[model samples]
Target: MRPTITGLGPLLDQIGADTGMTISTLGVLAAVPLVAWALFSPLAHDLSRRFGQPRVLLWSLVVLLAGTVVRSLPGPVVSLWIGTAVIGIGIAIINVLMPSVVKRDFAGHVPAVTALYTALLAGFGAISSGVVVPISHVELGGDPAGWRIALLVTGGILLPFAIAVWWWAHRGRRAHSRSASQHGRTGIWTDPLAWLVAAYMGLQASMFYMLVTWLAAISMSTGRSEVVAGVDVMVYQLFSLAGSLLLPLVLRGRIERFAPALIPSLAIVGAAGLMLAPGAILVWTPLLGLSSGATLGMSLTLMAQRARDHDAASALSGMSQSVGYVIAAMGPVVFGWLHSLTGGWTASLSLLLAVLVLLTVVGVFAGRDRYVLDSR
Candidate 1:
């Protein structure tokens, strides 16, 4: 995710320089994730039922590696789309299964562990987004081969995970085959709490993806260097990292007591930062990050909090992510389209503010002291 995101600014630059594509044209690269979601979301659950969750996690990375390698291949515009689509499928699988992995493996430590995982994950993403341009500028051999080097870095990062999984499988890890142990079924899709969680997930995801793809550009428009814009992106992500760590601690004793107020307040702060503070972006960026990070961490934690056990967690995870990501997939494209039509960032930023307002209202419902309707 970090690699894909980090590469976006440079990727767009590369495409524009080489092929005369516009930002909108390059943004279409995001469509690959949506297409994969539509194609493979149904398959993820079926595969989980058959091969089991851990195996699904392991194999997804293998496929992800293959996709990354193929993306580096030299070709015309078709290569970018095809490569991205393959990568999207791989990411989708991993995205759906990770929550299950967390529920099963970490058990009672969901909040702390989820925060740690997301922080580390986004931290790397932050680093990647900030550096991809510089790295490409310095290391790329010119022509298409430079893009290949950028792609290779991601593939290289994924290598160790594959090796570790292989090692763990050979050692006969027992957790891979164990079934999720929760009792009672409350058909999650029909539950209102599930939808609330899904909405929270979707809105947060949409906001983050849209900003990541555009924030550097946004800063650049403000007369900052791309490097400074990249650093601003990092500042936002760093705040996210800090918020993840801090919010979990803050919510530990009072998840049920304070969550409703806490979650919406965070979203409100983020919305303010994004929509209302262009002049003070240096200050607002980290504030936005902190708010977003807290909201995101809390949202994931709520999945475990609302579910009765690991089975419920896995099911809710699938439902929320499957639905949430599809919604999220629309964000960048929509924002870009709106930007195109409006001829500037103002209208698009306003639309996002509206989304955040909606997110806050819905997040209050999700963060309430209630379990899934099926659970209790």
Candidate 2:
């Protein structure tokens, strides 16, 4: 899932060269999957209810695998766009279902489990971002277009193994047994707390996705070589991993109350640093990375922690991610458009900083300990 977004950063130049698409167009391409995420996320809970989480998740993996192949195929540009949307659909379902799974199976250990998975997510994303360029430079089959193979290897290779592992793990598990009667009578969409969570999710996700899509390009624009820029992205992801690992440890007792707001404040600092002092990327990158990872972990945790049950968790996850990715899908395109229009990154970085401020405000309210749809 991470590779589909982060891994594509390093390959964008090559893709542009091959497709003759401008940065803004490529930004739209980058955002296609996010749009899919927004569109498909809402259906995941219902899909899981009908087919069960395990089955729906397994099918999603298959869809992801298929999308990976299609996206990597050497063909018309439309294939690339279609495949990306397919990949987004798969990931959207998986993203929404994961919280419910954790809520159901790791009810008492939500933070720890969310941390573990999010850490792995960041770690793999870092690996993909770091390695894709080098792999694309490799002369496989004497083909000059190594980016296709790089995309395939980075995004497609482990999917089958994951599918097998998932199947084996839940071979006989039944679908979620909860019925409509088990859910809150009021819709999760109407709950103020759920809206707060969704706002936090959208804001944080917009920041993360925007950076992953353009951070390497932003680094390269500063006169760094492509390889060095890729390294910068890797560093960002590693720091994100560190942040993910550290969040659960720090969220104990009283600290938990302020963590949501505090973490986004750190991100605001990072974005400001990037805008004001672009030369010190190494310093700012880690700040952004840490904040990105921790905020992501916190958002996922909120989905589970604030839910009354796994059902509510699914509903909350669906709503938050659905609304969240819609906002996120705009970030890269708008950022790229700003850069294209202004001929500089000042406006683009300002856009990011402004969003971070809004995120911080939403996080303050989202941090409260409350369940979705609760009358209290």
lDDT of each: 0.69, 0.89
TM-score of every model versus the real structure:
0.89, 0.97
Candidate 1 pairs with clashing backbones: 6-129
Native-vs-model 1 lDDT? 0.69
Each model's RMSD to truth, in Å? 2.9, 1.3
Alpha carbon deviation, residue 348, candidate 2 (Å): 0.6
Q: Count the backbone clashes (under 3 Å) in each candidate.
A: 1, 0
Instruction: Write the residue-wise lDDT of candidate 2 on 1-376 in tens digits.
Output: 7886688987889899999999999999989988998999999988888889999999999999999999988879888888888999999999999998999999999999999989999999999999999888887578654888889999988999999999999999987655754353247888899889988998888888888888998899889988889889999999999889999987999989888988877778888888888988899999999999999999999999999788899999999999999899999999999999999888999999998888888878988888887776
For model 1, residues 2-55, the per-residue Cα lDDT tens digits are: 465445653455656766777777666755665575457545655676677767
Candidate 2's TM-score reads 0.97
RMSD of 2: 1.3
Deviation in angstroms for 125 in model 1? Answer: 0.4
Give candidate 1 regions above 4 Å deviation: 139-145, 161-170, 174-186, 255-257, 264-267, 270-277, 373-376
Error of 1 at 81 (Å): 1.0
TM-score of 1: 0.89
